[model samples]
Structures are given as structure tokens and as C-alpha cells.
Target chain A: QQPVQSPQAVILREGEDAVINCSSSKALYSVHWYRQKHGEAPIFLMILLKGGEQKGHDKISASFNEKKQQSSLYLTASQLSYSGTYFCGTEPDNNDMRFGAGTRLTVKP
Target chain B: DVKVTQSSRYLVKRTGEKVFLECVQDMDHENMFWYRQDPGLGLRLIYFSYDVKMKEKGDIPEGYSVSREKKERFSLILESASTNQTSMYLCASSFLPRTEDGYTFGSGTRLTVV
Candidate 1:
């Protein structure tokens, strides 16, 4: 099943922060975060394993709670380049990987 | 860095025509995936391959068939194209499960079927 993402769209000013949440009905083995710019491919951001550890890449970070089947992507001090659609892919088991609906984020100057 | 390459950036097809989207990965990954993206719908998986000649149906695969005759190449075939199938198609590849890295996606093919 596909994950559910919160905040279908978000607008932010420079230096602002935003959070995109993804929740699943089934337990997840890992959660993957990606960002896609206009007319571009989805770029990998971070991956969180089921161990409840947070992964960080530059100003982007994510946390995965295996027991709760929840994952959140965090963007701090948003930049203009941060404008794009964000997607979270979850692996419910060893073989199945599914994605959420997505969150459109626009960061203005 | 892994490179996932899609054959075409844009394509137009007529209704009832057959459509093919190709994807190739240079990273020798064990998994390849096909997904379609539409506004508000996010990315919907159509098919995936784990090995040469191996395949699995994704969430939305009714109108799509997949071919993976080679390890590095995966193809998505639309048996009979329809206007409703017009969308951006994306190809991706990743290592086996538990590799700790996310998928590498191709630039995408913007397919418009009229």
C-alpha cells in the first residue's frame, strides 16, 4: 500500500523551515526521501532504516519510527533551490517498496 | 555516481498505438523500476525487475507490461496507448535491499498520447 503524506503543498520564505510527514499503515523496513525539481528526476535525499535513527544530509534530515510507521523529512533554512516536490518511499518488507502521494514545496527568495 | 538513462525525453503517441519506454543503468544494480508521475498523484510504480528476465507488477500495471531481457536494461511497454496514459514516465535503479542508498532515477520521459 502507498504511504500517506501530510501537507499536500507548502510555501516557505528564505530561511524558513518546513516538515513533510509520511505515515504508513504497515510496518516499514526503511524509508527513502527524494526531491524532484520541475522537469527533473527525483533526487535521493536520505534513507532511514528501521532502527529509529535519523539521517541527515546537509540541511535536510529525516527520522523514521518503525513502530509508529511514521517518517518525516525536515528542511531547515530553506533555500530557493529547495522548491520542488518531495516524495517518501517506504519498504514495508524485504521486497516491496512503495511511495507516498508527495508534498509540493516552494521556497521563495 | 550511478547513471540511469531513459531513451527519450518526450514522446507523442496516438490512441491504440503501442508505446515503449526504455531505461538503462550503469551501476549494475539488481533492481530496476518504472513509474509514472502526474500532478498531485506523485509517482506510481508500474513495474520492477530484480534480475535478467525477472519482473513484478507494481501498484498500477494494468495497461503496462515490462521486459527485462538483460541485466542493465528494463523496458515498459504500453500494449495500447490511451489519452489517459499521458504522463511523465520515470525509470530508476537501485542496489539490492539493505544497501543503504536510495534509488537513482532517470531524467524522465514526458509522454503525451492523444
Candidate 2:
């Protein structure tokens, strides 16, 4: 089954922060995050394994909650370049991986 | 940098026409995938090939087929194109058996079936 994402769309001002949530019903082996700009391909951001690790790059960070079978992406101090669609791909096991509908984010300067 | 190349950037096809979309990966990755992206539908996997001559059906693979005759190439075939099949097609590749591996995606082919 496909993962579920919350807040289908978000609008933010510069320097603000936003959180996007993704959850799955099955035991998640890993969670992958990707960002796609307008008319561009999706780019891999980070991957969180089952070990409950929190990974970050610059002001973007994410956490995987193994117990809840959920993951949240945190965008701090949002910039204009942060405007795009964010997708969360969930892996139940080595054989299956699926992505959510994606959360559209628009940041205004 | 790993590069996954898709042959056509845009294609227009009539109903019932046969369509072929090709992808090539220079990274020599073991896993190649074909997915279609639609608005509000995310990316739906059409098919995936792990090795040459080996293919697996994904979540939405009923109307699609794949071929991997060589290690660097994977092709998706639409036996009879329909309006519903019109969408942005993306090709991705990654290392096999690595649950945490991040996929490298191609620029994508926007196919329109009329």
C-alpha cells in the first residue's frame, strides 16, 4: 500500500519552518525523501533506516519513528528555493518500496 | 555523478498506438525502475528489472511491459497506448539489495496519448 502524507499543501513565508509527515501501516524498513522542483526530476534528499536515525542537511532534517511507523521532514528557516513538492518513499522490505502523494510547498519571500 | 538517461523528453501518440520508452544508466546499477507520475497520484511503479532478462511487476503494471536486454538499458513498452496512460514517465536506478540506497532519476519523458 502507498504511504500517507499529511497537509497536501503548505504555504510559508521566508525564515519560517514547516513539517511534513508520512506514515505507513506496515513495518517500515526504511524511509526515503525526495524533492522535485517545477518541471524537474525528483532529487534524493535522505534515507532513514529502521534504526531510528535522524539525518540532516543544512537546515533540512528528518526523523524516522520505528515504533509509530512514521517519518517527519523538518524544513527550518525556509527559503524561496525550498518551494517544491516533497515526496516520502517508504520501504516495507527489500522487495517493496512505494511513495506517497507528495506535499506541495510554496515559500514566499 | 550517476546518470540515468531517458531517450525522449516529450512524445505524443494516438490511441491504440504502440509506445516504447528507453532508459540507460551509466552507473551500471543493478536495479532499474519505470514509474509514471501524475498530479495528485504520486509516482506509481510500472515495472522494474533487476538484471538482464529479469523483470518484475510493480504496483501498477497491468498495462505495461519491460525489457532489459543489456546491463545498461531498460525499456518500457506500452502495447496499446490509451489516454489514461498519458503521464510523466520517470526512470530510476539504484544498487540492489541495499534497503537504504537512494535512487538516481532521469529527467523524465512526458508522454501524451490522445
Candidate 3:
């Protein structure tokens, strides 16, 4: 099943921070984060496996709560380049991965 | 660098016509997936293959089929193209299932059915 993402859309100014959340109805084995700019393929950001596991990529980081079947992505000091759609891919115990609807983030100057 | 390449970037087909979308991964990944991306629906999986000659239907597989004759190439086939089938199709490959390694995605093909 596909996960549900909150704050379908968000707007931020440069140097601001934003958080996107994803929740799934099924138990999760791992969670992956990806960002896609307009007309571009989604790019992998990070993958979190164990409960409470957190991984960071520059100003972006994500945490997975296996128990809660949820994951959250944190974008710190956002830049204009950060404007894109963020998707969370949830992998259940069955090893099937499905993506959330995604959160549109627009970073302005 | 690992690369997942989709054969077409854009395609336009008439209704009732058959269409094929090809994907190739050079990383020797064991898992390949086909997904269609829509405006607000996100990416919906149509089919996936874990090995050559093996395929599984994904979340949305109706009106679609897949081929994995070779380990590196995966193809998604539309039995009969319809207007509703128009969308951006994406291909991805992963080294392992439920592994820490993230998937490598292709640029995607924008298909339009008239």
C-alpha cells in the first residue's frame, strides 16, 4: 500500500527549514527518501532501516520509526535548489516498495 | 556510476495501439521496477522483476504487462493504449530487496495516448 504524506505542499524562504512526514498503514522494513525536480527523474536521498535510524545528506536528513510505520524528512537551511517534490518510499516486510503521494516544496529567495 | 536508462523520453500513441517502454540498468541489479507517475498520485508500480524471466504484478498492473528476457533490460508493455494510460513512466533498479542500498532511477518516459 502507498504511504500518506502530510503538508501536501509547503513554501519556504532561503535559509528556512521544513519537515515532511510520511505514514503507512503497513509495517515497514525500511524507508527511502527521494527528491524530483520538475521533469526530472527522482533522485535517491537516503535510506533508513532500523527503528529510529537517521541518515543525513548535506542539509537534508531523514528518520525512520519502524514501530510507528512512519518516516520524516528534514530539510535545514533550504536553498532555491531544494525546490522540488519529496517522496517517501516504504518497504514492507514483504520487500515491496511503494511511494507516497509526495510533498511539493518551493524554496524562494 | 550506476545507470538506469529508459529507452524513450517521450512517446505519443493512438488509442488501441500497443506500446512498449524499455529500461536498461548497467549495475547488474537484481531487481527492476516499472512505475507510472501522475500529477498528484505519485508513482504507482505496474510491475517488477527480481530476476530474468521472473515478473510480478505491482499495485496497478491492469492493461499492462512486462518482459524481462535479459537480466539488464526490463520492458513494460501496454496491451492497448488508451487516453487514461498517458503518464510519465519511470524505471528503477535495486541491488537487493529491502536492502540499505537505494534504487537507481531512469529519467522516465512521458507517454501520451490519444
Models ranked on lDDT: 2, 3, 1
lDDT of 2 at B25: 96
Over the stretch A1-109, how does candidate 2's per-residue lDDT look in tens digits?
A: 8899988999999999999999999899899999999889899999999999999989999999999999999999999999999999998875556899999999998
- The digit string of per-residue lDDT tens for model 3 on A2-109 reads 999988999999999999999999988789999999988899889998668788999999888888898999999999999999999998876668999999999999
lDDT (Cα atoms) of all candidates against the true structure: 0.92, 0.93, 0.93
**Tens digit per residue, CA lDDT, model 1, A11-109:** 999999999999999888899999998888999888898999998888999999998999999999999999999999998775657889899999998
Give the per-residue Cα lDDT of candidate 2 at A9: 98
- Lowest-scoring 10 consecutive residues by lDDT in candidate 3 chain A? A88-97
Return the top candidate by DockQ. Answer: 3
- The C-alpha stretches of model 1 lying farther than 4 A from their native spots are none
State which docking tier applies to candidate 3. high
Q: What tens-digit string does per-residue lDDT give for candidate 2 at B1-107?
A: 77999999999999999899999999878899999999998998889888999999999998789999999999999999999999999999988887455989999
Question: For residue B50, what is the lDDT in candidate 2?
Answer: 84
Q: What is the lDDT of candidate 3?
A: 0.93
Taking chain A of model 3 alone, its TM-score versus the true chain A equals: 0.97
